[model samples]
Target: MRLDPPPTTPESEHRRRIGAVQEAMKREGFKLLIAYADCWRTANVRYFTDFRPVDGVHTIAQAVIALPAESDPTLFTGDGCLDYAASETAFDVAELEHLPLYLRRHLNADGRVALAGEEQIPVGLHRTIAEAIAPAPLVASNLLAKIKAVKSPWELEQLRHAAVLTDLGMEAVQQAVSTAGQVTERQLARAADVAMINAGADTPAYLSMVQAGPRSAFSLALPTNRVLERGDLVLTDIGARYGNYVADGGRGFVYGPPSGQAREIIDAAADAVEAGLAAARPGISAADLNGAIQAVLIERGYAEFSGEARGRGTGHGTGMDPEEELPWIGPTDHTVIEQGSVFTLKATINHPQVGGLRTERIVHLGATGLELLDTFPMRNFW
Candidate 1:
């Protein structure tokens, strides 16, 4: 399938992001390497050469950009490169490009090299690369993962754009909840999802969640066509992906007349999320944030959480390619909050007798403290 039109990445900024990885590899002992990436299928290689593949809605897995220790990086992709890569990508590459041939042409055989990507790399390609390199076991190390986990200035800006789009999508969801006689669970899901896509999000991150009334009672939530009615509560867990970055959040809304009890649960969840965000900073551990929030829920006497919510951390890092990363912003997590990390703050409290209430937002670690990246309000939709 033909992907979306390419995005023009600033040449210098692209180089700088990769340069950080190059420097880190030098510190370790690998003389050469490849930063492999597939935006599902279209290999949007972002590196010194400035190629970021923008695939419209394809599920990418094997695509990757290989960067040698000292060479201009190139993309290795399937036949789609002829259509998408040549016209849209920042740097064009050979189609159905064999990694070994590309390596022989680009990298020296005798030098020590480190491989990229997760353990899921195709075994056939893995064997081929192993045979060519000298008999050194290029252990599975996540050099690129570590380097890219921290967002660059340009990356953060893209994330900001994504957050804005997602916020608007949530607003649409609020409107849908307010005007409908009774929202079918699936339709509510589509409303928020369509809102994101219409607002320039490349796609909704996933089938956004819509759990209604008792349906919201489950920790593992799914969207169904159940008609919501009065005294029914609705919770939507939603996110939008743009420019390869994403913004995810959740909010609850009342369908019919509100009950005093339902309002209390929504307020509690929102306050818990706020309490957690307030605790997030450079010095605090992930567990600290989780503890702060859970303390509120536990005090309110709703200790039970959706899917063992206490076990769920507030959130983790997000950036190009890698979906989630370090600083699991919840209790018992030791990941330290650091400058440059962007995380989502979410708290969903589930009650089997009633329903569930949740509030989520995006937050970044600032030089001074935690800065809220999301603007969506915490209250259940009006």
Candidate 2:
């Protein structure tokens, strides 16, 4: 629980990541790569330069890392953040306005330009870059995402610490639910947030979810002032962030002694998670892992509440971002699981009459098999 000198990604690792992206660009015939980041979606730029921009009402925080095929990469940010970016990032820092000039200097007439964060980039800036590098054709690229799917040793360590903090938060929620008289959902969520921060978390990975009774039927809901009652099914989904890496998981709990239907729903979700964990390995496809989980839910007569029925995946990759797109654990994703890949293995079942139940675990695929990063028990009835 005590990390005197917190673990961090060294400067050398950032250099190595830049090299990997450059190699990918080479293969894709990209002459220049523009990686963009904002306060919200920061993985692309932060992965390469290690500079997380700060956003404010007066100051719009945005960053771009321009990596040309032939020269060293440059990090560009707002004038307000130039000094901070220079101090934090390993690459050369420049003002945001210079990005067009940098692109003009490095880009050739015939070569194509690849953009890593096309969706998040502002339309005006995108048009400017497109005009600046006219005839070069800006194309969306998933090079960074593909590379980030696999975790390095250092990233795995950070994730492990994140998982520990997340578990502590969940433990605090359980204790609050059991001991507090007439506790509200908001209070439980506050308890979790305080516990994670006190346990050395940078912050909660996302807003803590505390849904009780029929409110739990929704897949995602923010904590409200609804008070707990006896025999009410409570669903809590919480996570913690440490060193910019995050761990996500959820569990089902009861305010008091559980009902027979509540017990059945919780057990089915936990069983599905177990099946998914057993089927997870290096060689399997994401679809196969999801199938294992789905099979359990269907066998338990919860077919209507399966992930496919709900039009959502069972889980997704978790790292620099809480929900990554790669290594997507669902029926449609065909990406192969690789060693050192970390993702959430979750089973969520929502019955119209019985309410909703979910159980999730942060798992890492190693050379041997899947390793569960979370240590908390799956079932909770208080």
What's the lDDT for all of these models?
0.68, 0.84
Per-model TM values vs. the true structure: 0.84, 0.95
lDDT of 2 by residue, 1-382 (tens): 5443345579888877778888999999999999888877678888876578886632247888888876789998888988888888776899888888888878779989999888888898899899999988999988877888889988899999999999999999988877887899899999999999988998888889988888888778898999988988888899988877889989988777888999998888888888888888879998888888877888888777666435377788888888875778888878788788899988887776667867989999999988899999888888
True-structure lDDT of candidate 1: 0.68
Reference-based lDDT, residue 99, model 1:
67
Lowest summed-lDDT stretch of 10 residues in model 2?
A: 1-10
The per-residue C-alpha lDDT of model 1 at residue 233 equals 70
- Best lDDT goes to which candidate? 2
Model 2, residue 213: distance off in Å is 1.3
lDDT of 1 by residue, 236-293 (tens): 8888777657777777877767788788888888888878877777778778777887
